[model samples]
Target: MTDANTTLPKTNSSPWTSRPFHRQYLMRQANNLFDFFEAPSLNPKGGFFELDDEGKALSAANSTRQVHGTTRMVHSFAIGSLIGRPGSGEMVDHGMDYIWNKHRDAKHGGYVWGLDDNGVTDGTKQAYGHAFVMLAASSAKLVGHPLADKMLADVTEVIERRFWDEKVGAVREEFANDWSQITTYRGQNSNMHLTEALMAAYEATGEKAYLTKAERIAELIIAKHAVPLGHRVAEHFDENWVLDKQYLGSEMFRPSGVTPGHALEWARLLMQLWILGDKRLSWMTDAARNLFRQAIELGWDTQHGGFFYTLDWDNKPIMREKLWWPVAEAIGAAAFLSAYDRDDYFQIWYRKLWDHAENHVIDHARGGWLSELTEDLKPTSRLFTGKPDIYHALQACLIPLYPATGSLTAAIIEAEHTVKQHH
Candidate 1:
């Protein structure tokens, strides 16, 4: 029996709160890291390097080895920008020097974008790749990492000089090894994602330039990409902020279905901007709420109870599938909304998210999550049956402190367990 009151929890520790499932994931990530450092084998007996057909990262390979994107995203949480303690061992990258790698292409500016078939940094770099670097570096700064400033500065210059669409005042898709911008229609996913990274960067450094660019692009996400009445965002855009109706590629997984995570990330960014006192984008918060409810109505699985990976705008079932990232973003929304304590209408959504994460996705047996489950809450991707470093774990780490969840003690206990595994 839990009470649904708005009283904030009095926590002495950091803002990151956790639960059983989060603790399990944290432990799995930790054990997996230990396994990577301690275990030595050819394949390493884990699925950390599973790549989608298009070379996008899929999941962790083994206990110690995490995929390139997974490693970057997990660092976002551990670097302590949003919801965790800072300056910890979970950050020291033995997998690959994500921050300060002299071995990779220095001309590329961003870290090596991919690992070779034999486990070395491949030289190609993508805009999305640099975005993750900014996010992780900003988070590292929040945690008192001495190198945070350098990480933030290096990546910021790379994006500003290379990815920036000077005509439209935004970023493009990919860049050459020498930081030359790829002349193609940009991806709204990475653009939004880069804005998100910029938001964190602004929070870390209080640099007016970062915040200013982030605000302009965030407005573009609304005016340029966001469809007003339809409650959907354009997944791709031209340099002038026009919607490219011929949406192709996994720039967003748009060809698959409506991605809930992307929308939520925008919502949180809007709120963060609001906190920064950029009230010009305040209307976007309501728009963000509309998208959030759109996601809840369309993505939430009624019988099985979890979010579908993709769905239609009118609450219609397109794929009716589930993915790890959307659930993670949904967790982000619930936590951010919990801080608002506005009308009591939002509590139900948070409860549904908590209920689903606890019951279906978390694997208490293996000390992590199953990674991917179907709309009916059955397993889908065995690639991450063990704990994989992912954005989901970072998002989950914040759920307990939001005050919407009933037990602070439980969340704290879970955070404690998670940090123990990581530290």
Candidate 2:
């Protein structure tokens, strides 16, 4: 229940930000996650298995692999490899091989949405999935995976040729397998993630085009849309790039009204974009602040110490259930905002958010972070079943360990180089 604008005395005593012990704690948490997901996530049939609550594969033979889950495993394990974790390289290799051999549409030229042992369960090509594909490729490239270059090139082509709508400076939402039946529904979630992938891709390849596209998406989404709405990120839009306030597609992905988690996510991404663009886009920093403010102001459940999943146009909490990713993203955003402005407010929130995670979200007895929780912060699986994701929690632990200026991969590389030089 801390006010976003509550001015407090500046203090440099945040243990999470300054202490060596807390740094080690962060690394320990990260490595625990890597150890948790690295084994069971690998599916011998093809892509990753959806893990159950106890960190076991839910199904091996008949499990369906969503593009986002598959790609996230690749991306997370690549980070593991970069940090010199054992068996991480093989995890990356397995994901790369599966992506190329199984997920990639050999006939259709775009990646499929879902696959199983019988093959192609859902053939719709989504910008959201493709964004994660780009992310996996870029992370794999950083780890020196042999297939990274080809995969990156292919996904880039698919995104440009099919998804990228130059008229609006953002990618289109979804399409059918044969590149037909293009959906007229436009969304900010996919585009936001694509901005992340493009930045990571730019870091991997030194491609200005990728960075430029990322900048365009940031401007289109955050500056053009969210800024006008008091920094509340509108989730759904129409083909004409107009806001579709009444559009409610899915409970998991496309939900009604505003998503505070995405606002928290954009706050972090906008700061990274600003830093990567040499801080030329000054408006990005301001936008990041406002978005974070709005999210905290409107989304935070003051009584429960967690963020609400969704909010209405009136800034009322719609889905009051708490989820893990938003708290994770809030940690990341607060870390960057604190680093940039040296404000005690951000620093205080950074610590408080992590405290919340340690208390409620993270399954200390188990392995991965719990996905869903009730308003009072008890574990629940109403929306997400089992512990199927490591991306958000991993980033929450790792992003703070480095400076806020670049992609986590780049920051990892730079840190390694500095370590070797000093030695």
**C-alpha lDDT of all candidate models, in order:** 0.55, 0.91
Which ranges in model 2 have alpha carbons more than 4 Å from their true place?
A: 1-15
Off by over 4 Å in 1: 1-87, 93-98, 102-104, 117-122, 179-183, 227-229, 251-257, 278-280, 312-315, 382-388, 399-423
Across 1-423, the per-residue lDDT of candidate 1 in tens digits comes to: 122343334451222334555556544453433333222212232213433322223443422232345345435334332333443344333322433653235654566565534443445566776777787676666555666677778878878876786667678776556655555666667777777677767756668887778777776776555646365666666666666655555522334335666676666666656656455556766766766766565556666766665555454665555666667677666666656645443555565565676687655444345567766777775333333444455455444343332122223444566778998
Residue range 1-423, candidate 2, lDDT tens digits: 364344554464553766898899999999989878888888888778988889998886699999999999999999989988899999899989999998899998989999999998999999999999999999999999999999999999999999998988999999989888677999999999999999999999999999999999999998999999999998898899999999978989998999999999999999999999989999999999989888988899888789999999998888888999999999999988998885567777887798899889889998889999998888888889998699999999999998677888888998899899999
Q: How far off is residue 235 in model 1, in Å? A: 1.2
lDDT of 2 at 128: 98
- Best-fitting candidate, measured by lDDT? 2
What's the CA error at residue 331 for candidate 1, in Å? 1.9
Displacement of residue 268 (Cα, Å) in model 2 is 0.8
